[model samples]
Target: MDLAIETNNLKKYFGDIHAVDGIDLQIPRGSLFGVLGPHGAGKTTTLRMLSTILHPTSGEAAVLGFDIKKDAREIKKRIGVCPQELVLYPRLSARENIHLIAQMHGMAKKDYKERTDELLGKMNLLDRASSLVKGYSGGMKRRINVLMAVIHEPELLFFDEPTAGLDPQSRRVVWDFIRDFQEKESTIILTTHSMEEADDLSDELIIIDHGKIISQGTPDELKGKLGEGDILEFKIKEMEQRDEIIELAKTLDFVRWGKPVGKHRIVLNALDGLRRVSEIMDVVKVKMEDISVRKNTLEDVFIDLTGRRLRD
Candidate 1:
Protein backbone atom coordinates (compact mmCIF):
# COMPACT_ATOMS: atom_id res chain seq x y z
CA MET A 1 0.00 0.00 0.00
CA ASP A 2 1.15 3.50 -0.80
CA LEU A 3 1.35 5.99 2.06
CA ALA A 4 0.24 9.50 1.28
CA ILE A 5 1.14 10.65 4.80
CA GLU A 6 3.12 9.34 7.77
CA THR A 7 4.34 10.40 11.21
CA ASN A 8 6.64 8.88 13.81
CA ASN A 9 6.55 10.00 17.43
CA LEU A 10 5.07 13.36 16.42
CA LYS A 11 4.91 15.70 19.39
CA LYS A 12 3.89 19.31 20.00
CA TYR A 13 4.11 21.30 23.20
CA PHE A 14 2.27 24.49 24.12
CA GLY A 15 4.36 25.84 26.98
CA ASP A 16 3.39 23.55 29.87
CA ILE A 17 0.84 21.61 27.89
CA HIS A 18 1.90 18.74 25.68
CA ALA A 19 -0.70 19.61 23.09
CA VAL A 20 0.29 16.79 20.74
CA ASP A 21 1.99 14.01 22.64
CA GLY A 22 3.91 11.44 20.66
CA ILE A 23 1.62 10.10 17.91
CA ASP A 24 2.28 7.79 15.00
CA LEU A 25 0.00 7.81 11.98
CA GLN A 26 -0.07 6.26 8.52
CA ILE A 27 -2.46 7.25 5.77
CA PRO A 28 -2.78 5.30 2.53
CA ARG A 29 -3.20 7.02 -0.81
CA GLY A 30 -6.77 7.68 -2.02
CA SER A 31 -8.26 6.75 1.32
CA LEU A 32 -10.44 8.90 3.60
CA PHE A 33 -8.78 8.88 7.01
CA GLY A 34 -10.51 10.28 10.10
CA VAL A 35 -8.88 11.71 13.22
CA LEU A 36 -11.49 11.38 15.92
CA GLY A 37 -11.45 12.53 19.51
CA PRO A 38 -13.18 14.80 21.99
CA HIS A 39 -12.79 18.56 21.78
CA GLY A 40 -9.26 19.75 22.75
CA ALA A 41 -7.86 16.31 21.93
CA GLY A 42 -5.13 17.91 19.76
CA LYS A 43 -6.89 17.14 16.48
CA THR A 44 -6.57 20.69 15.17
CA THR A 45 -2.98 20.78 16.38
CA THR A 46 -2.15 17.58 14.50
CA LEU A 47 -3.75 18.88 11.31
CA ARG A 48 -1.75 22.07 11.62
CA MET A 49 1.50 20.14 12.00
CA LEU A 50 0.66 17.87 9.05
CA SER A 51 -0.12 20.92 6.93
CA THR A 52 3.21 22.47 7.94
CA ILE A 53 1.57 25.46 9.67
CA LEU A 54 2.87 24.42 13.10
CA HIS A 55 6.28 22.87 13.73
CA PRO A 56 6.51 19.75 15.80
CA THR A 57 8.33 19.82 19.12
CA SER A 58 9.76 16.34 18.45
CA GLY A 59 9.50 13.52 15.88
CA GLU A 60 9.21 13.31 12.10
CA ALA A 61 6.33 13.65 9.65
CA ALA A 62 6.07 13.48 5.90
CA VAL A 63 3.45 14.28 3.30
CA LEU A 64 3.32 12.72 -0.17
CA GLY A 65 6.72 11.17 0.59
CA PHE A 66 8.29 14.61 1.03
CA ASP A 67 9.91 15.06 4.44
CA ILE A 68 7.77 17.68 6.14
CA LYS A 69 10.86 19.37 7.57
CA LYS A 70 13.08 19.24 4.49
CA ASP A 71 10.43 19.95 1.86
CA ALA A 72 7.86 22.22 3.46
CA ARG A 73 7.61 24.48 0.43
CA GLU A 74 6.82 21.59 -1.87
CA ILE A 75 4.48 20.07 0.71
CA LYS A 76 2.63 23.37 1.07
CA LYS A 77 2.16 23.53 -2.69
CA ARG A 78 0.72 20.01 -2.75
CA ILE A 79 -1.62 20.03 0.26
CA GLY A 80 -4.56 22.13 1.42
CA VAL A 81 -5.69 22.87 4.97
CA CYS A 82 -9.20 24.01 5.89
CA PRO A 83 -9.15 24.97 9.53
CA GLN A 84 -12.02 24.56 11.97
CA GLU A 85 -12.23 28.31 12.29
CA LEU A 86 -13.92 30.07 9.38
CA VAL A 87 -11.47 31.61 6.91
CA LEU A 88 -13.15 33.97 4.47
CA TYR A 89 -12.99 37.66 3.72
CA PRO A 90 -16.73 37.90 4.37
CA ARG A 91 -16.68 40.93 2.08
CA LEU A 92 -15.73 38.87 -0.97
CA SER A 93 -18.29 37.01 -3.02
CA ALA A 94 -18.25 33.21 -2.94
CA ARG A 95 -16.67 33.06 -6.39
CA GLU A 96 -14.23 35.81 -5.44
CA ASN A 97 -13.06 33.81 -2.41
CA ILE A 98 -12.10 30.81 -4.50
CA HIS A 99 -10.50 33.08 -7.02
CA LEU A 100 -8.39 34.77 -4.30
CA ILE A 101 -7.18 31.39 -3.01
CA ALA A 102 -6.40 30.26 -6.56
CA GLN A 103 -4.41 33.40 -7.25
CA MET A 104 -2.53 33.09 -3.95
CA HIS A 105 -1.56 29.54 -4.89
CA GLY A 106 -0.18 30.98 -8.19
CA MET A 107 -2.64 29.10 -10.37
CA ALA A 108 -2.89 30.26 -13.94
CA LYS A 109 -6.00 32.31 -14.64
CA LYS A 110 -6.87 30.18 -17.67
CA ASP A 111 -6.58 26.95 -15.68
CA TYR A 112 -8.32 28.24 -12.54
CA LYS A 113 -11.31 29.76 -14.31
CA GLU A 114 -12.86 26.44 -15.30
CA ARG A 115 -11.74 24.65 -12.13
CA THR A 116 -13.27 27.27 -9.80
CA ASP A 117 -16.55 27.16 -11.68
CA GLU A 118 -16.56 23.37 -11.56
CA LEU A 119 -16.01 23.36 -7.80
CA LEU A 120 -18.63 26.00 -7.22
CA GLY A 121 -21.13 23.92 -9.13
CA LYS A 122 -20.17 20.81 -7.21
CA MET A 123 -20.59 22.61 -3.87
CA ASN A 124 -24.04 23.89 -4.96
CA LEU A 125 -22.83 27.47 -4.59
CA LEU A 126 -22.88 28.31 -8.29
CA ASP A 127 -26.25 30.02 -7.94
CA ARG A 128 -24.85 32.07 -5.08
CA ALA A 129 -21.48 32.49 -6.70
CA SER A 130 -21.49 36.25 -6.68
CA SER A 131 -23.10 36.72 -3.29
CA LEU A 132 -20.80 38.29 -0.71
CA VAL A 133 -19.68 35.77 1.91
CA LYS A 134 -20.91 38.21 4.60
CA GLY A 135 -24.47 37.60 3.48
CA TYR A 136 -24.19 33.84 3.23
CA SER A 137 -25.48 31.40 5.85
CA GLY A 138 -23.13 29.41 8.11
CA GLY A 139 -23.40 26.40 5.86
CA MET A 140 -22.92 28.44 2.71
CA LYS A 141 -19.71 29.96 4.06
CA ARG A 142 -18.42 26.53 5.08
CA ARG A 143 -19.07 25.24 1.57
CA ILE A 144 -17.08 28.10 0.11
CA ASN A 145 -14.29 27.54 2.68
CA VAL A 146 -14.02 23.94 1.52
CA LEU A 147 -14.08 25.04 -2.13
CA MET A 148 -11.18 27.37 -1.46
CA ALA A 149 -9.01 24.42 -0.43
CA VAL A 150 -9.76 22.33 -3.53
CA ILE A 151 -9.79 25.03 -6.22
CA HIS A 152 -6.04 24.62 -6.68
CA GLU A 153 -6.48 20.85 -7.00
CA PRO A 154 -4.01 19.78 -4.33
CA GLU A 155 -3.11 16.10 -3.98
CA LEU A 156 -3.96 15.97 -0.26
CA LEU A 157 -6.55 17.95 1.72
CA PHE A 158 -6.87 18.48 5.46
CA PHE A 159 -10.31 19.28 6.79
CA ASP A 160 -10.76 20.31 10.42
CA GLU A 161 -14.36 19.88 11.56
CA PRO A 162 -15.48 20.30 7.94
CA THR A 163 -19.24 19.95 8.34
CA ALA A 164 -19.45 21.57 11.73
CA GLY A 165 -22.29 24.04 12.31
CA LEU A 166 -24.02 23.11 9.03
CA ASP A 167 -27.57 22.10 8.35
CA PRO A 168 -28.27 18.55 7.23
CA GLN A 169 -28.52 19.60 3.58
CA SER A 170 -25.21 21.50 3.65
CA ARG A 171 -23.56 18.65 5.55
CA ARG A 172 -24.71 16.28 2.84
CA VAL A 173 -23.28 18.61 0.20
CA VAL A 174 -19.89 18.60 1.94
CA TRP A 175 -20.01 14.81 2.25
CA ASP A 176 -20.75 14.46 -1.46
CA PHE A 177 -17.83 16.67 -2.43
CA ILE A 178 -15.51 14.54 -0.27
CA ARG A 179 -16.89 11.38 -1.85
CA ASP A 180 -16.40 12.84 -5.33
CA PHE A 181 -12.86 13.93 -4.50
CA GLN A 182 -11.98 10.42 -3.26
CA GLU A 183 -13.42 8.94 -6.46
CA LYS A 184 -10.93 11.13 -8.32
CA GLU A 185 -8.16 9.62 -6.13
CA SER A 186 -7.57 12.58 -3.77
CA THR A 187 -6.44 11.57 -0.28
CA ILE A 188 -8.17 13.32 2.64
CA ILE A 189 -7.32 13.65 6.33
CA LEU A 190 -10.24 14.90 8.38
CA THR A 191 -10.90 15.62 12.05
CA THR A 192 -14.43 15.24 13.36
CA HIS A 193 -16.33 14.92 16.65
CA SER A 194 -19.22 13.13 14.94
CA MET A 195 -18.86 9.39 15.36
CA GLU A 196 -21.40 8.70 12.63
CA GLU A 197 -19.53 11.02 10.30
CA ALA A 198 -16.29 9.10 10.91
CA ASP A 199 -18.10 5.77 10.62
CA ASP A 200 -19.83 6.78 7.41
CA LEU A 201 -16.90 8.17 5.41
CA SER A 202 -13.59 6.99 6.85
CA ASP A 203 -11.70 3.92 5.59
CA GLU A 204 -9.48 4.27 8.67
CA LEU A 205 -10.09 5.88 12.06
CA ILE A 206 -7.66 7.12 14.71
CA ILE A 207 -8.76 8.02 18.21
CA ILE A 208 -6.77 10.41 20.35
CA ASP A 209 -7.04 11.35 24.00
CA HIS A 210 -5.11 14.02 25.85
CA GLY A 211 -2.82 14.46 22.83
CA LYS A 212 -1.89 10.78 22.61
CA ILE A 213 -3.03 8.18 20.12
CA ILE A 214 -5.12 5.60 21.96
CA SER A 215 -6.58 3.60 19.10
CA GLN A 216 -5.92 3.27 15.39
CA GLY A 217 -7.51 0.85 12.90
CA THR A 218 -10.23 0.37 10.30
CA PRO A 219 -13.71 1.10 11.67
CA ASP A 220 -14.84 -2.49 11.42
CA GLU A 221 -11.56 -3.68 12.88
CA LEU A 222 -12.08 -1.53 15.98
CA LYS A 223 -15.70 -2.56 16.25
CA GLY A 224 -14.78 -6.23 15.99
CA LYS A 225 -12.61 -5.82 19.09
CA LEU A 226 -15.71 -5.35 21.22
CA GLY A 227 -15.56 -9.11 21.88
CA GLU A 228 -19.27 -9.69 22.32
CA GLY A 229 -22.20 -10.25 20.00
CA ASP A 230 -25.01 -8.27 21.64
CA ILE A 231 -25.18 -5.55 24.27
CA LEU A 232 -28.11 -5.33 26.64
CA GLU A 233 -28.40 -1.95 28.37
CA PHE A 234 -30.58 -1.63 31.43
CA LYS A 235 -31.47 1.77 32.79
CA ILE A 236 -32.60 1.71 36.33
CA LYS A 237 -33.98 4.38 38.64
CA GLU A 238 -31.47 3.66 41.40
CA MET A 239 -27.81 2.64 41.64
CA GLU A 240 -28.30 0.49 44.73
CA GLN A 241 -30.29 -2.04 42.70
CA ARG A 242 -27.23 -2.89 40.52
CA ASP A 243 -26.08 -5.60 42.92
CA GLU A 244 -29.37 -7.44 42.54
CA ILE A 245 -29.30 -7.14 38.74
CA ILE A 246 -25.67 -8.29 38.57
CA GLU A 247 -26.38 -11.30 40.75
CA LEU A 248 -29.42 -12.22 38.68
CA ALA A 249 -27.75 -11.68 35.29
CA LYS A 250 -24.79 -13.92 36.16
CA THR A 251 -26.96 -17.03 36.42
CA LEU A 252 -27.18 -17.39 32.62
CA ASP A 253 -24.42 -19.37 30.90
CA PHE A 254 -24.63 -17.34 27.67
CA VAL A 255 -24.05 -14.09 29.52
CA ARG A 256 -20.34 -13.40 29.33
CA TRP A 257 -20.51 -10.40 31.64
CA GLY A 258 -22.78 -7.76 33.13
CA LYS A 259 -21.56 -4.33 34.20
CA PRO A 260 -22.69 -0.77 34.79
CA VAL A 261 -23.24 1.57 31.88
CA GLY A 262 -23.05 4.32 34.48
CA LYS A 263 -23.88 4.46 38.16
CA HIS A 264 -27.50 3.54 37.40
CA ARG A 265 -27.42 1.96 33.95
CA ILE A 266 -26.36 -1.66 33.61
CA VAL A 267 -24.92 -3.26 30.46
CA LEU A 268 -24.72 -6.97 29.76
CA ASN A 269 -22.70 -8.85 27.18
CA ALA A 270 -24.27 -12.02 25.90
CA LEU A 271 -23.31 -14.41 23.10
CA ASP A 272 -25.94 -15.70 20.68
CA GLY A 273 -28.49 -13.16 21.86
CA LEU A 274 -30.88 -14.10 19.08
CA ARG A 275 -31.10 -17.50 20.69
CA ARG A 276 -30.78 -16.29 24.26
CA VAL A 277 -32.54 -12.89 24.96
CA SER A 278 -35.54 -14.73 26.37
CA GLU A 279 -33.40 -17.13 28.32
CA ILE A 280 -31.16 -14.35 29.61
CA MET A 281 -34.13 -12.21 30.59
CA ASP A 282 -35.67 -15.10 32.46
CA VAL A 283 -32.49 -15.50 34.48
CA VAL A 284 -32.42 -11.78 35.23
CA LYS A 285 -36.16 -11.92 36.04
CA VAL A 286 -36.67 -8.66 34.12
CA LYS A 287 -39.33 -7.96 31.50
CA MET A 288 -37.99 -7.85 27.91
CA GLU A 289 -39.56 -4.43 27.36
CA ASP A 290 -37.57 -2.97 30.25
CA ILE A 291 -34.18 -3.38 28.61
CA SER A 292 -32.75 -1.99 25.39
CA VAL A 293 -30.70 -4.19 23.11
CA ARG A 294 -28.12 -2.85 20.68
CA LYS A 295 -25.25 -4.34 18.76
CA ASN A 296 -21.76 -3.60 20.07
CA THR A 297 -20.45 -0.40 18.49
CA LEU A 298 -17.46 1.92 18.35
CA GLU A 299 -19.16 4.08 20.97
CA ASP A 300 -19.15 1.10 23.31
CA VAL A 301 -15.50 0.46 22.55
CA PHE A 302 -14.62 4.05 23.37
CA ILE A 303 -16.54 3.88 26.59
CA ASP A 304 -14.76 0.68 27.51
CA LEU A 305 -11.36 2.11 26.67
CA THR A 306 -11.72 5.56 28.18
CA GLY A 307 -14.58 5.15 30.60
CA ARG A 308 -16.32 8.05 28.93
CA ARG A 309 -18.10 9.16 25.77
CA LEU A 310 -16.08 10.17 22.71
CA ARG A 311 -17.36 13.72 23.11
CA ASP A 312 -16.55 13.95 26.78
Candidate 2:
Protein backbone atom coordinates (compact mmCIF):
# COMPACT_ATOMS: atom_id res chain seq x y z
CA MET A 1 0.00 0.00 0.00
CA ASP A 2 1.08 3.59 -0.53
CA LEU A 3 1.52 4.76 3.04
CA ALA A 4 1.54 8.42 4.04
CA ILE A 5 2.54 7.60 7.60
CA GLU A 6 3.66 4.48 9.50
CA THR A 7 5.11 3.77 12.91
CA ASN A 8 6.24 0.85 15.05
CA ASN A 9 6.58 0.72 18.80
CA LEU A 10 6.50 4.51 19.02
CA LYS A 11 7.17 5.68 22.56
CA LYS A 12 7.51 9.00 24.34
CA TYR A 13 8.18 9.28 28.05
CA PHE A 14 8.09 12.32 30.27
CA GLY A 15 9.86 11.15 33.45
CA ASP A 16 7.53 8.52 35.00
CA ILE A 17 4.67 9.15 32.60
CA HIS A 18 4.82 6.94 29.51
CA ALA A 19 3.00 9.48 27.41
CA VAL A 20 3.01 7.48 24.15
CA ASP A 21 3.98 4.01 25.19
CA GLY A 22 4.74 1.46 22.51
CA ILE A 23 2.16 1.93 19.71
CA ASP A 24 2.04 1.14 15.99
CA LEU A 25 0.20 3.00 13.23
CA GLN A 26 -0.21 3.03 9.48
CA ILE A 27 -2.11 5.69 7.52
CA PRO A 28 -2.49 5.28 3.78
CA ARG A 29 -2.09 7.91 1.11
CA GLY A 30 -5.19 9.86 0.02
CA SER A 31 -7.26 8.77 3.02
CA LEU A 32 -8.63 10.95 5.81
CA PHE A 33 -7.61 9.36 9.13
CA GLY A 34 -8.81 10.11 12.66
CA VAL A 35 -7.09 9.63 16.02
CA LEU A 36 -9.68 9.54 18.83
CA GLY A 37 -8.80 9.61 22.51
CA PRO A 38 -9.73 11.28 25.78
CA HIS A 39 -7.51 13.94 27.32
CA GLY A 40 -4.01 12.79 28.40
CA ALA A 41 -4.30 9.74 26.15
CA GLY A 42 -1.04 10.45 24.25
CA LYS A 43 -2.75 11.56 21.02
CA THR A 44 -0.96 14.92 21.03
CA THR A 45 2.39 13.44 21.93
CA THR A 46 2.10 10.95 19.08
CA LEU A 47 1.25 13.76 16.70
CA ARG A 48 4.28 15.68 17.85
CA MET A 49 6.55 12.74 17.02
CA LEU A 50 4.97 12.27 13.59
CA SER A 51 5.27 16.01 12.85
CA THR A 52 8.94 15.95 13.92
CA ILE A 53 8.40 18.59 16.59
CA LEU A 54 9.36 16.04 19.27
CA HIS A 55 11.68 13.08 18.99
CA PRO A 56 10.56 9.65 20.12
CA THR A 57 12.38 8.18 23.09
CA SER A 58 12.32 4.79 21.31
CA GLY A 59 10.74 2.99 18.30
CA GLU A 60 10.83 3.77 14.59
CA ALA A 61 8.53 5.93 12.51
CA ALA A 62 8.14 7.43 9.09
CA VAL A 63 6.04 10.14 7.47
CA LEU A 64 5.44 10.74 3.79
CA GLY A 65 8.07 8.09 3.00
CA PHE A 66 10.73 9.81 5.16
CA ASP A 67 12.07 8.05 8.23
CA ILE A 68 11.32 10.08 11.37
CA LYS A 69 14.87 9.81 12.73
CA LYS A 70 16.94 9.88 9.55
CA ASP A 71 14.85 11.88 7.12
CA ALA A 72 13.16 14.27 9.51
CA ARG A 73 13.98 17.33 7.50
CA GLU A 74 12.45 15.80 4.38
CA ILE A 75 9.39 14.65 6.30
CA LYS A 76 8.94 18.08 7.82
CA LYS A 77 8.96 19.68 4.41
CA ARG A 78 6.26 17.38 3.01
CA ILE A 79 3.93 17.47 5.99
CA GLY A 80 1.82 20.44 7.13
CA VAL A 81 0.72 20.61 10.77
CA CYS A 82 -2.10 22.66 12.30
CA PRO A 83 -1.47 22.42 16.02
CA GLN A 84 -4.16 22.53 18.69
CA GLU A 85 -3.05 25.89 20.03
CA LEU A 86 -3.14 28.94 17.78
CA VAL A 87 0.34 30.17 16.71
CA LEU A 88 -0.46 33.28 14.74
CA TYR A 89 1.03 36.77 14.74
CA PRO A 90 -1.70 38.93 16.28
CA ARG A 91 -0.32 42.09 14.70
CA LEU A 92 0.07 40.62 11.19
CA SER A 93 -2.73 40.47 8.66
CA ALA A 94 -3.67 36.98 7.42
CA ARG A 95 -2.23 37.59 3.96
CA GLU A 96 1.08 38.85 5.27
CA ASN A 97 1.50 35.87 7.54
CA ILE A 98 0.77 33.41 4.73
CA HIS A 99 2.97 35.32 2.31
CA LEU A 100 5.83 35.25 4.77
CA ILE A 101 5.57 31.47 5.15
CA ALA A 102 5.33 31.08 1.39
CA GLN A 103 8.50 33.11 0.98
CA MET A 104 10.27 31.03 3.63
CA HIS A 105 9.30 27.90 1.74
CA GLY A 106 10.95 29.44 -1.33
CA MET A 107 7.75 29.64 -3.33
CA ALA A 108 8.39 31.22 -6.76
CA LYS A 109 7.48 34.90 -7.12
CA LYS A 110 4.43 34.26 -9.36
CA ASP A 111 3.39 31.14 -7.41
CA TYR A 112 3.66 32.92 -4.07
CA LYS A 113 1.39 35.74 -5.21
CA GLU A 114 -1.09 33.33 -6.80
CA ARG A 115 -1.24 30.83 -3.91
CA THR A 116 -1.69 33.53 -1.28
CA ASP A 117 -4.69 35.00 -3.09
CA GLU A 118 -6.13 31.58 -3.82
CA LEU A 119 -5.97 30.23 -0.24
CA LEU A 120 -7.30 33.43 1.31
CA GLY A 121 -10.25 33.33 -1.10
CA LYS A 122 -10.88 29.64 -0.58
CA MET A 123 -10.89 29.92 3.23
CA ASN A 124 -13.44 32.77 2.99
CA LEU A 125 -11.01 35.18 4.65
CA LEU A 126 -10.48 37.42 1.61
CA ASP A 127 -12.77 40.04 3.11
CA ARG A 128 -10.58 40.16 6.21
CA ALA A 129 -7.31 39.59 4.38
CA SER A 130 -5.84 42.94 5.36
CA SER A 131 -7.14 43.05 8.95
CA LEU A 132 -4.83 42.23 11.87
CA VAL A 133 -5.19 38.69 13.21
CA LYS A 134 -5.95 40.23 16.63
CA GLY A 135 -9.32 41.38 15.28
CA TYR A 136 -10.33 37.88 14.11
CA SER A 137 -12.93 35.80 15.92
CA GLY A 138 -12.01 32.49 17.51
CA GLY A 139 -13.33 30.54 14.55
CA MET A 140 -11.73 32.88 12.05
CA LYS A 141 -8.36 32.70 13.80
CA ARG A 142 -8.56 28.91 13.81
CA ARG A 143 -9.25 28.89 10.07
CA ILE A 144 -6.28 31.13 9.40
CA ASN A 145 -4.08 28.99 11.60
CA VAL A 146 -4.98 26.01 9.47
CA LEU A 147 -4.53 28.02 6.28
CA MET A 148 -1.03 29.10 7.22
CA ALA A 149 0.04 25.53 7.87
CA VAL A 150 -0.88 24.54 4.32
CA ILE A 151 0.47 27.60 2.54
CA HIS A 152 3.49 25.64 1.37
CA GLU A 153 1.12 23.11 -0.29
CA PRO A 154 2.41 20.03 1.52
CA GLU A 155 0.99 16.70 0.36
CA LEU A 156 0.33 15.34 3.88
CA LEU A 157 -1.47 17.34 6.57
CA PHE A 158 -1.96 16.98 10.30
CA PHE A 159 -4.77 18.89 12.05
CA ASP A 160 -4.84 18.53 15.82
CA GLU A 161 -8.33 19.52 16.99
CA PRO A 162 -8.83 21.86 14.06
CA THR A 163 -12.39 22.72 15.08
CA ALA A 164 -12.07 22.20 18.82
CA GLY A 165 -13.68 25.44 19.98
CA LEU A 166 -15.53 26.57 16.88
CA ASP A 167 -19.27 27.19 16.65
CA PRO A 168 -21.41 24.77 14.65
CA GLN A 169 -21.36 27.02 11.58
CA SER A 170 -17.61 27.49 11.78
CA ARG A 171 -17.03 23.79 12.29
CA ARG A 172 -19.15 23.08 9.24
CA VAL A 173 -17.08 25.50 7.20
CA VAL A 174 -13.85 23.85 8.37
CA TRP A 175 -15.30 20.49 7.41
CA ASP A 176 -16.04 21.87 3.96
CA PHE A 177 -12.40 22.80 3.47
CA ILE A 178 -11.31 19.35 4.64
CA ARG A 179 -13.67 17.76 2.15
CA ASP A 180 -12.27 19.98 -0.55
CA PHE A 181 -8.75 18.91 0.36
CA GLN A 182 -9.76 15.27 0.04
CA GLU A 183 -11.26 16.00 -3.36
CA LYS A 184 -8.02 17.58 -4.43
CA GLU A 185 -6.18 14.36 -3.44
CA SER A 186 -4.35 15.26 -0.21
CA THR A 187 -4.03 12.86 2.70
CA ILE A 188 -5.15 14.15 6.13
CA ILE A 189 -4.55 12.92 9.66
CA LEU A 190 -6.83 14.52 12.26
CA THR A 191 -7.09 14.07 16.02
CA THR A 192 -10.33 15.03 17.76
CA HIS A 193 -12.41 13.89 20.73
CA SER A 194 -15.69 14.81 19.03
CA MET A 195 -17.45 11.65 17.88
CA GLU A 196 -19.57 13.62 15.42
CA GLU A 197 -16.53 15.11 13.72
CA ALA A 198 -14.67 11.77 13.53
CA ASP A 199 -17.72 9.94 12.19
CA ASP A 200 -18.35 12.61 9.60
CA LEU A 201 -14.79 13.14 8.40
CA SER A 202 -12.73 9.97 8.82
CA ASP A 203 -12.25 7.31 6.17
CA GLU A 204 -10.48 5.23 8.84
CA LEU A 205 -10.32 5.52 12.64
CA ILE A 206 -7.98 4.73 15.53
CA ILE A 207 -8.52 4.94 19.28
CA ILE A 208 -5.72 5.22 21.83
CA ASP A 209 -5.84 4.93 25.61
CA HIS A 210 -3.15 5.03 28.28
CA GLY A 211 -0.51 5.49 25.60
CA LYS A 212 -1.54 2.60 23.34
CA ILE A 213 -3.97 1.89 20.52
CA ILE A 214 -7.03 0.02 21.75
CA SER A 215 -8.76 -0.21 18.38
CA GLN A 216 -8.38 0.57 14.67
CA GLY A 217 -10.62 0.14 11.63
CA THR A 218 -13.22 1.94 9.58
CA PRO A 219 -15.93 3.52 11.77
CA ASP A 220 -18.47 0.98 10.58
CA GLU A 221 -16.10 -1.92 11.15
CA LEU A 222 -15.60 -1.15 14.84
CA LYS A 223 -19.25 -0.29 15.30
CA GLY A 224 -19.90 -3.78 13.84
CA LYS A 225 -17.79 -5.22 16.64
CA LEU A 226 -20.77 -4.45 18.80
CA GLY A 227 -22.87 -7.57 19.36
CA GLU A 228 -26.42 -7.19 18.18
CA GLY A 229 -27.54 -5.42 21.34
CA ASP A 230 -29.00 -2.23 22.71
CA ILE A 231 -27.56 0.22 25.21
CA LEU A 232 -29.65 2.28 27.63
CA GLU A 233 -28.29 5.47 29.16
CA PHE A 234 -29.71 6.93 32.36
CA LYS A 235 -28.72 10.06 34.21
CA ILE A 236 -29.33 9.46 37.90
CA LYS A 237 -29.58 12.06 40.60
CA GLU A 238 -28.37 9.50 43.14
CA MET A 239 -25.29 7.24 43.10
CA GLU A 240 -25.64 4.32 45.57
CA GLN A 241 -29.20 3.67 44.41
CA ARG A 242 -27.98 3.50 40.81
CA ASP A 243 -25.25 0.99 41.79
CA GLU A 244 -27.66 -1.15 43.78
CA ILE A 245 -30.00 -1.33 40.82
CA ILE A 246 -27.20 -2.15 38.42
CA GLU A 247 -26.05 -4.94 40.77
CA LEU A 248 -29.49 -6.49 40.39
CA ALA A 249 -29.13 -6.03 36.66
CA LYS A 250 -25.97 -8.21 36.76
CA THR A 251 -28.17 -11.21 37.68
CA LEU A 252 -30.24 -10.90 34.50
CA ASP A 253 -29.07 -13.05 31.59
CA PHE A 254 -30.25 -10.53 29.01
CA VAL A 255 -28.02 -7.81 30.40
CA ARG A 256 -24.37 -8.01 29.30
CA TRP A 257 -23.07 -5.22 31.49
CA GLY A 258 -24.47 -2.68 33.96
CA LYS A 259 -21.94 0.07 34.52
CA PRO A 260 -22.13 3.38 36.30
CA VAL A 261 -21.10 6.23 34.03
CA GLY A 262 -20.47 8.91 36.63
CA LYS A 263 -21.43 9.70 40.20
CA HIS A 264 -25.11 9.65 39.28
CA ARG A 265 -25.52 7.87 35.93
CA ILE A 266 -25.55 4.25 34.74
CA VAL A 267 -25.53 2.61 31.33
CA LEU A 268 -26.85 -0.87 30.58
CA ASN A 269 -25.94 -2.89 27.51
CA ALA A 270 -28.42 -5.66 26.92
CA LEU A 271 -29.59 -8.10 24.31
CA ASP A 272 -32.82 -7.00 22.63
CA GLY A 273 -32.31 -3.72 24.52
CA LEU A 274 -35.66 -2.07 23.80
CA ARG A 275 -37.67 -5.20 24.70
CA ARG A 276 -35.91 -5.45 28.07
CA VAL A 277 -35.86 -1.71 28.78
CA SER A 278 -39.16 -1.73 30.66
CA GLU A 279 -38.08 -4.82 32.58
CA ILE A 280 -34.90 -2.95 33.55
CA MET A 281 -36.97 -0.13 35.03
CA ASP A 282 -39.02 -2.66 37.00
CA VAL A 283 -35.91 -4.59 38.04
CA VAL A 284 -34.08 -1.52 39.20
CA LYS A 285 -37.25 0.09 40.58
CA VAL A 286 -35.86 3.55 39.96
CA LYS A 287 -37.51 6.55 38.34
CA MET A 288 -35.15 8.27 35.97
CA GLU A 289 -36.19 11.60 34.57
CA ASP A 290 -34.22 10.96 31.42
CA ILE A 291 -33.61 7.55 29.82
CA SER A 292 -32.52 6.82 26.31
CA VAL A 293 -31.72 3.57 24.49
CA ARG A 294 -30.15 3.21 21.06
CA LYS A 295 -27.80 1.22 18.87
CA ASN A 296 -24.09 1.29 19.71
CA THR A 297 -22.14 4.50 19.20
CA LEU A 298 -18.42 5.34 19.05
CA GLU A 299 -18.69 6.52 22.66
CA ASP A 300 -20.08 3.15 23.79
CA VAL A 301 -17.08 1.42 22.27
CA PHE A 302 -14.77 3.81 24.06
CA ILE A 303 -16.48 3.10 27.35
CA ASP A 304 -16.50 -0.63 26.70
CA LEU A 305 -12.75 -0.72 26.32
CA THR A 306 -11.70 1.92 28.85
CA GLY A 307 -14.42 1.46 31.50
CA ARG A 308 -17.41 3.77 32.00
CA ARG A 309 -15.98 5.98 34.74
CA LEU A 310 -14.29 9.28 33.90
CA ARG A 311 -10.51 9.38 33.42
CA ASP A 312 -8.41 11.82 35.40
Which candidate wins on lDDT? 2
Weakest 10 consecutive residues, lDDT, candidate 1?
281-290
Candidate 2 on 91-180: residue-level lDDT in tens?
A: 999988888877777788888778888888988889999999999999889998888878888799899989989999889989988888
What are the TM-scores, per candidate, against the unseen true structure?
0.88, 0.92
Model 2, stretches more than 4 Å misplaced?
241-244, 250-256, 270-276, 309-312
In model 1, state the lDDT of residue 180: 87
Candidate 1: C-alpha RMSD to true structure equals 2.8
Could you tell me which residue pairs clash in candidate 2?
A: none
Instruction: Give the Å shift of residue 285 in candidate 2.
Output: 1.5
lDDT of 1: 0.84
